[model samples]
Target: MDTNQAGPAAEEALARQEQETITQAIAKELGISVKQVRTTVGLLDEGNTIPFIARYRKEMTGELDENVLRDIEERLSYLRNLGDRKKDVLRSIEEQGKLTQELQEQILKAVKLQEVEDLYRPFRQKRKTRASVAKEKGLEPLADWVMEQRRQGQPLEEAAKYIDAEKGVESAELALQGAMDIIAENIADDPTIRSWVRQYTASQGILVSEAKDAEQESVYENYYNYREPVHKMPPHRILAINRGERENVLKVGIEVTADKIHAFILRKLVKGPSPVKELLEAVTEDAYKRLIAPSVEREVRGEMTEKGETQAISIFSGNLRSLLLQPPVKGRNVLGVDPAYRTGCKLAVVDDTGKLLEVAVTYPTPPNNKKREAAAKFKELIAKYGIQLIVIGNGTGSRETEQFTAEVIAEIGDPGLAYLIVNEAGASVYSASKLAQEEFPDLDVAERSAASIARRVQDPLAELVKIDPKAIGVGQYQHDVSQKHLEESLKGVVESAVNHVGVDVNTASASLLSYVAGVNATIAKNIVKFREENGKFTTRKQLQKVPRLGAKSYEQCIGFLRIPGGDNTLDRTPIHPESYPVVDRLFRELGLDVASLGSKEVAEQLQAQDAAELAVKLDVGVPTLRDILESLQRPGRDPREELPLPIFRTDVLKIEDLVPGMEMQGTVRNVIDFGAFVDIGIKNDGLVHISQLSGSYVKHPMDVVSVGDNVTVWVLGVDLKKGRVSLTMRPPSGNDGGAK
Candidate 1:
């Protein structure tokens, strides 16, 4: 049968089989029913977004939340892609006339793309090599005879048969050498052997790294002489060693004994004692040293890197979500300060609504030495604008600026004036952006940064959306990972956060609205334009009139967008428009008007009604009814308010003031794999290592704290010269004067 004769019909049938295989695999891997997997896949295939399907298609998907739905969608795509790659591999091998039933079955059973590639490697065409050259010289027959490993007569005489001078096989020795080369290549290329070797080495190998120049000081000093088991090495250590190796500060490799690999290969391939056993033994050792070990080492390192990148991206995603969802310091006039030394501090005061009311500059540190004058000027501006909160950017000269602000507030004798230290990671990025330029054409970069600093405290989600997620310094080694993958994951995180906390359609900036369930950048801009041209959206129905926002887009996005004080009261809540009739019926049954939502009487009635009975009465799923009831309880409530608030300080603490056993309040600035970095009112943030995160075992530091958690940490140690602070969240022992 000609493999080329596989027609479209056959191809289509194969594709259908492949898709079914992928569906079954996903269902088992995700621990969900096959029906749920199939329905979710169909929804995704039909262009339904994760947020939309999670929120609206509860009846079809069994109420899978956003995270589960996203996991299923991601795994579905990966498995389908894996299946496609398998087909391509099969076709390529068949085209080469090397496809066997056993090989095909192995390829079909493979789950990972790496496994498929390993299976296809031997048949893959190669550049000019010793193996190819030997085969070209017609020595392959001898190699095959050697691979047979039968108790044959003398192998030298057998090699003599292939020794033809005309074909460049000048002597029996030359022919034997070429055959040995071919045999070694065959041993190295065997898929089964490679798989076992890879797995064994990964489990038993030790990753060793040593300093290239031990005397030189570098950030990788701790890793200069590091050795850890490959299977037990943590992701951060792997990434750090990789970075060190790439920077030429260290040499890294996986160390495994040749004896172990040798025994494994011989056990699998060697059948019995033969005349050519010694030759085969030498060939196997040569294959491992020259061909197999290097390849397997590369594979193991790549796997480690990929795993590290995945963990780093997950940490970044979680931290970004927590940071973006930090509760807004509502209804406070904030004065933002972009601190600097040679250049004066840039200040911008914004109203409770994030409207810029004032901008000023004062030299507070170094060369200028105008502390008194700066304090007097800031106090005057605070009095003039009635500033209730002062946000200082945690950047250059931040400590000095914070101290100055505290002194000025105390001098003014205004107990209402408090200060907070904002992360300000991407403020400069946002300030120099085109969006910032259009927003404040007249202000300089520093002034714009001050405005952003102020707006972040007022509304983090709205302001953070204007900057790229990558620029925000939340994750470790974000710049070293795959940018495309990182960006995709971060974008999903932003979307999840935005949809989780509904947006205000009337007042949301294009940046914020762009992250809604179905609204893209173009549509978000159009929505803002519509609002600017027409009036505020009075009802969710008005979204239909927005050009380019069609029915499908409205259905996907309307549930995530809120219109406070709109003509329809349901517009402000999370209840989908399709469920409005159900809510109306419930309202009538409860003898409450739609306008009386969130009223005391209505709240009482809702509390008294049985949710199960109410769900049946409304003819909606219990999930939808429960969500509606939650929305009614608090219309347009921000979920972030339920979490801890940012720590505010009326006085400043320098690094010199810290001592062992001193306890202080701080906010979690960043969470990483090894520990959490907390701001303890100093020049540098303190590290609460994973061991110190809790009294018991913790799988991850993020499980204990988040980016905005206000925790009480005791100072374990402080290095004033190095500007390092070590902290512990675990309460002190009773013997230590009951220190917190």
Candidate 2:
């Protein structure tokens, strides 16, 4: 037998053991079942996407939701990487011939990467320093003598024995200085001491900031003399302070009690009264002030920044999800308006399917003031296109354009005609892009923007996916946070939204298809190309025929790609193609034709049967069986249809029109940590502060409302000078008037 063959097997066994250890750790941290963690880890290791595992592998994961599964995936990756790093560190230490059993155990027991790094600090290679210089001078024996804490003689008297002029120790004092340097380095390198000081400083420190220019009236004025407890500070405030400091507007630092840290270190390093006790005490202070304090401060601030970025990314992700999942305004012929002043109000009339029918420009505000002419042109377009809804971009001159649109509607007396102010944040960016130019070569920037605005209301997901998610304006301090992390999180949000709602394979653009569970940019384009060449896909099986889309991609993606009128009605639903056998058996056992699905008779039959009992009969899990039954009931149903729709209006109101205690209906435009901006048919969206979000205490604005929520708010106050309008969701007192 070849002895080397066992080496590979041994390494594989070791890898498996490490993976099990990480899995067990994650299970304990998340307080989930070990079996669940193991199964999820196995599935993720098998290259199944999070959405696929969450939706399809319920039996393996014990029905963990997407959020939990994602958490598991992140933790698993982190722990596995940490374990690998630990192994590397251990190997390096062992190779140096300095590894001890105690140190090995400590490294193995470390929970965080920081903890492992701290343990490895002393062993880490360093550049030439004072300690290394002293060692180079052959003064290491003197340093060790000082560390021994001999009580029989004075340190300088003991140090004189090691003084050698040739070795650069000219005198006892010089030898003592080098010894103290070694002692300081030793104290600085103690992991236990460093860890304790870090914990103490973090718990007791205050983050203080002072304005660099106290007289300047900037947005950071509130932070001019800010001081907040490090432990209790909010993530937003930390990010704000960090930005303020980065911009040179404020000086920030962590303030901790120096005497307390010094005393603690002295008590740990000094065992008893000795000839070198005083020198050692001074070295302790020098180690902390010169070495430990600065490093610990950076670590604490870095930790805070990381935490703040995490929170900011989470907020952005949630907001993006809500914005992407807004309900589509189906079957509505709409006219889109890109509001402007000096130029003209650009218009694009799109049919219900977002197909542009006409484009024109009319001067409605400022330079021309062609109000009547614009109204006449709008009315003509409305009648010509049979336009049911008007979507106006809330940009420059939006208020005047909306007033003109309202007047046009009122004159026509078409109650069915309503206008909506769509947030056109990235419309211009999209319009000027290569994609937009390719999509519409003849249209100008404003014209393309108008079309995008119209299509946003028709189908928000489809239209918004064309623009970069970061430019969608659903986040706070998005640019200030980690761009890579933010992009990753936003992309994940879009992917989750796309997969959750599913996709119409025939109508979906490559931009939308690229975010599907298993699809990439290349595969998305290939799928669209295949569709264009081969015609509409009639069944999920046809996906495998697309070049570069293999069996794995088809299996991962086919379930989330829908065909409304396909050969298999199950294809129109979220049911996987692999489960057709179970469905066929179900239909045979029930004596029902698959074509009879969603019919009244089938609905009644499904409602009368117990899904759990049927699941056992069909040899499938209850969750899968329930999902199949739901799909059978409502084929090709859009999950977005269940969410609240965008608010529409036939009239416009200025900020001055708002009065205290007057109620009005509004649409949630953007939700942040502090409040929500609501568009209540006004030029400027009103602010619903976190405190005013509900009648009771509210933890976060998102907990009360999300983007696209149609809410009834009372006008609290309006500052027309600053163009600020404050609103509240809470009901007014008995004396206050209601909606006007």
What lDDT is reached at residue 610 by model 1? Answer: 78
RMSD of each: 2.3, 2.6
Model 2 per-residue lDDT tens digits across residues 596-646: 888888988877779889999999998888888877877788999987677
Candidate 1 colliding pairs: none
lDDT of 1 by residue, 597-680 (tens): 778777777777777888887788887887787788777788877876688889999888888999789889899999999998
- lDDT values, one for every candidate: 0.89, 0.88
Worst 10 residues of 2 by lDDT: 731-740
Candidate 2 residues lying further than 4 Å off, grouped into runs, are 1-6, 161-169, 733-740
